[model samples]
Target: MKTIHKIAFLMIMSTQLSFAQSSEDQKIMQLSKDKWQWMSDKNVETLAALFDEKSVFVHMGGSWGKQQEIDVIKNGGIWYKKATIHDVSVNIIDNTAIILTKMDLLAVVGGNEVTNPFIVTEVYIKKDGSWKLGSLSFTKTLSPSGK
Candidate 1:
């Protein structure tokens, strides 16, 4: 019947859309992991290419622009020693993706090594078919102390 045909068409369309969204999620997730690696390695050049010119980074200590963030990493103001992700979830809306990751972060800030649990929000925007980091905000779940 006509009702059956319409139902089947809708189902197919829904599945196709889900697949597309899943693909985007995977791409963004991979990029996020790569970004963490770049941070750990202090690869400011790669991060500069990935970060939007007007991107913002928020930390417990302060918030800064893309260039300032790059400078901090390059100058060793804060060293991202390691990140152990506990969970990560991603949501994609049109050309933008929002990712929330809970992790245990080990870092050396101001010459002191510390560890803390944090929830990091990372925003990415698709531009010219490539994703660029728009913003990164880190919320500490617990106060950092010597690990």
Candidate 2:
């Protein structure tokens, strides 16, 4: 009788833990959407809040720090007029999460305007009960001409 009671208690505890984790994952996805909206509106202040102090930004051109990303946002480097996301997959690992997706950005690059599609990988980390982006990597999908 004692062993059966203990087993039941352990099962209940595991189920509760799984439910809590699922809730957190949902929140994380919502966070990503919030960040995307912030970027789409060119709201630098709000987007800046999404990145952690020790975050990394990796673009096809180069890698940048949190401040660099903020500077670009403020300077309109990305000029993210609009964006669309597709085929997204999110995975959680311990306190870390990874999001991969195909993204299309209507942006201005170096004085020329264009719409570019890229494969993006975003990493987020949970710290002090809050989740913030730890890293972002993007690989441009080029045309056959490689332009």
Candidate 3:
């Protein structure tokens, strides 16, 4: 009887832990989706709030810090017109969350519009009770055969 009770209690606790982790994962995923929309809209005010002071952005051209990224967006250096997200996965470690997103990005860079497949990695850290983007890096990927 005691053995059975112990087993059941452990199972319940395990389930609760799983549920908590799932909830955190969902929250981070949604935040990532919203960020894409905000980038498309050029909503720098909201993005500035979400970006950590020391956040870094890595791009095909070069890497830069938070302010330069915001400036690039604001000045139409790279207009993130849309992102067709194919898949996304998020993992949390301690106070940091890392998200991997597979997608095709439609953007206007240097006044030329283009679409490219990319695997975007975003790192977020929980700070002062809120999650802030710590880093974002994009890696271009070869498209699958055909369209």
Candidate 4:
């Protein structure tokens, strides 16, 4: 009877842990979605607050740091007009969260509008009770069949 009770208690604890992890994952996912909108809207003030000072950004044309990324968005250098997110997954390890997003990005680069399929990786680190984006990298990928 004692052994059975122990097993049931362990199972309940495991289920609670799973629920906690799921909640954290959902928060990160929502943050990522909001980030895409902020970028599309050129909300640099909010983005600057979310991005860590040491954050890095990788693009098809080049890679840059947080300030340069903000400048690019503010100056319309590479306007992130829209992002149609097809899929997203987030994993949390310790105080860091890594997110993988599959999406179609519509943007204006050098005044030319284009659409591309990309797998975007975003890393966020929790510090002082808040999360800050540490890195964002975009990898161009071939479009899936049927748009």
Candidate 2 C-alpha lDDT tens digits along 59-104: 8689989999888877878766766776677799989999876778
lDDT (0 to 1) per candidate: 0.92, 0.81, 0.95, 0.94
Q: Compare candidates 1 and 3 on lDDT and give the better one.
A: 3
Cα lDDT of model 1 by residue, 52-126, tens digit = 998999999999999999999999999999998988999888899999998989999999998878999999999
Better candidate number, 1 or 2, judged by TM-score: 1
Model 4 accuracy (lDDT, Cα): 0.94
Ranking of all predicted structures according to lDDT, beginning with the best and ending with the worst: 3, 4, 1, 2
- Where does candidate 2 stray beyond 4 Å? 1-18, 142-147
User: What number of backbone clashes does candidate 2 have, counting pairs of residues 3 or more apart or in separate chains?
Assistant: 0
Better of 1 and 2 by lDDT: 1
Model 1 residue 106 CA deviation in Å:
0.5
My TM-score estimates for the predictions, one after another, are 0.91, 0.80, 0.96, 0.95
Cα RMSD of all models vs. native, in order, equals 3.1, 3.9, 2.0, 1.8
RMSD in Å for model 4: 1.8
The regions of model 1 sitting more than 4 angstroms off are: 143-147
